[model samples]
Structures are given as structure tokens and as C-alpha cells.
Target: MTRIKNLADLHKIKEEVQSKNRLRSSLDYPEHLVQIKVGMATCGIASGAKETMKYLNDELEQQAIDAVVTKTGCLGYCYAEPTIEVTLPGKEPVVFGYVDKAKVVEIIDVYIKRGEQVEGIIPLNFQTIDD
Candidate 1:
């Protein structure tokens, strides 16, 4: 981590973090924004879900994508730890497994940006209450 050499530098870092948090937690008209749910359960964390979540959050902001990246529970896909469920506006949510840095980039570029499908998607067999 970079050392905070002065109070101004510390404030700058804090503001940066706050900006990212606001973007990730934004819920206004959520139906119009891309919704990314990262599995953060124990199994998921063990598989490096924290890194996955951080990368997703940072990349989305850097790309200026209007998205909300939130954390969820197990998602019932223990075999596919570090999984993420992405819901594009006006579409059904799709869960992808084994998400790493490269997968996150592909997901943002191909799936999220261009609305194209990528591999590693875990087919949803169960329906949610909303369905």
C-alpha cells in the first residue's frame, strides 16, 4: 500500500474510497443500472471472492459503467465458489462461476457492456421468489 505522507494525501484517499462506495451502493432506479452480486460466503471468500469483488468494483468505476456491486451470501453454489450473479437492465440475472480478474474484465466488456454472453455461466436451475 502507498504510504500516506500527509493529511491531504489521507483525505484524498478517503474521498476516492467514498466515491467508489457510493457507486457500488447506488440503488436509485436500480432497474436501470447493472446489478452485480458477488458471493461472499466463507466458501466464496476462501476462493478469493474478496479480490474478485474489489476488482469488479474498481473496474466498473474505471470504465464509467453505471453499476451496483453488492455482496450476497452463499448463492447455493459452493462448487462454484467466487461466483457472481449479474443482472442487466430489463433482463434475467445470470450467474457465472470461477470469476477471476480476467473473467471480470470479460464480463464487463462482453457481457455487461455489449450484452454478449460469455462462458463459465452457471445455468440457473432454481427460481427465485421474484420469479
Candidate 2:
């Protein structure tokens, strides 16, 4: 680890560390609430999933929304990297794809807040897994 050289450097290091830790632990929120899972696989990372995940965490906190945001492996939609699945309490999960910061905000505002579904949802033509 690099040593802190001054007060500013120390604070910067602390903030960076906190951000990383926040990313890892943000999913620990109670299960009864909504859960937001973002694909963080290699393809997802190449598609800006890291920034999207961070944006979700920060925006959720800023908006005072209490939801769990976690990173997950590939959801098999490589064409739509950076896919996100939102599991609202007592409701079926909805997956959105090709997400960016704007889409992320729209998800939070429309889906999470107003319960309105936006575009980019992968069609569920067939079901293999039984709930």
C-alpha cells in the first residue's frame, strides 16, 4: 500500500478505500427491500458496468432510497453488457440492458420510484428455471 504523504493525500486515500468498500458491501442491506443486481463480468466491465454500479450506489444514497445494490456474474446477455436486474419486494425481477448513467437514473426514478417500466428489457420468451 502507498503511504499517505499529507493530510490531503490521506483524505483522498481514505475516500478511495471507502468507495471500494462501499461497492463491495452495499448489497448487505436487508433482503425485504428492493435489490438491484448489476452484471460485473468481464464483458460487463468492458461495457461500463463499474461506473454504472457506482452511480447507482451514490444516486440511491443521495435520493434516500433504501435498496441493496450488488454485482453479479454474467446474465447470459453478452450483447447487452451492463445489464441490471431489479427485484422489487414481493415482485418478479426485471432485467434491463445496455445501461448508462441516464438509463440508471431513469430506472431509479421510473421503475423504483414510480413503478413504471422503461425500455431495454430482454423479452422473456421462454422459461427454463422454475421459481
Query: Considering every candidate listed, which one attains the maximal TM-score?
Result: 1
Screening candidate 2 with a backbone cut-off below 3 angstroms (N, C-alpha, C), the clashing residue pairs are: none
Give the Å error, residue 87, model 2: 0.7
**Residue 110 lDDT in candidate 2:** 95
The local lDDT score (0 to 100) that residue 106 gets in candidate 2 is 96
Q: Candidate 1, 96: how far from true, in Å?
A: 0.4
Superposed Cα RMSD, model 1? 9.7
- Writing each residue's lDDT as its tens digit, candidate 1 over 24-85 gives 44554433678889999999999999999999999999989988788999988999889999
> Considering summed lDDT, which 10 consecutive residues are worst modelled in model 2?
22-31
Off by over 4 Å in 2: 1-31, 129-131
Model 2 Cα lDDT, one tens digit per residue, 1-131 = 78778999989988997765455344453435677899999999999999999999999999998788989998889899889998776567899999999999999999989988799998755667774
- Candidate 1 stretches with Cα past 4 Å from truth are 1-31, 128-131
Each model's TM-score? 0.74, 0.72
For candidate 2, the per-residue lDDT at 46 reads: 96
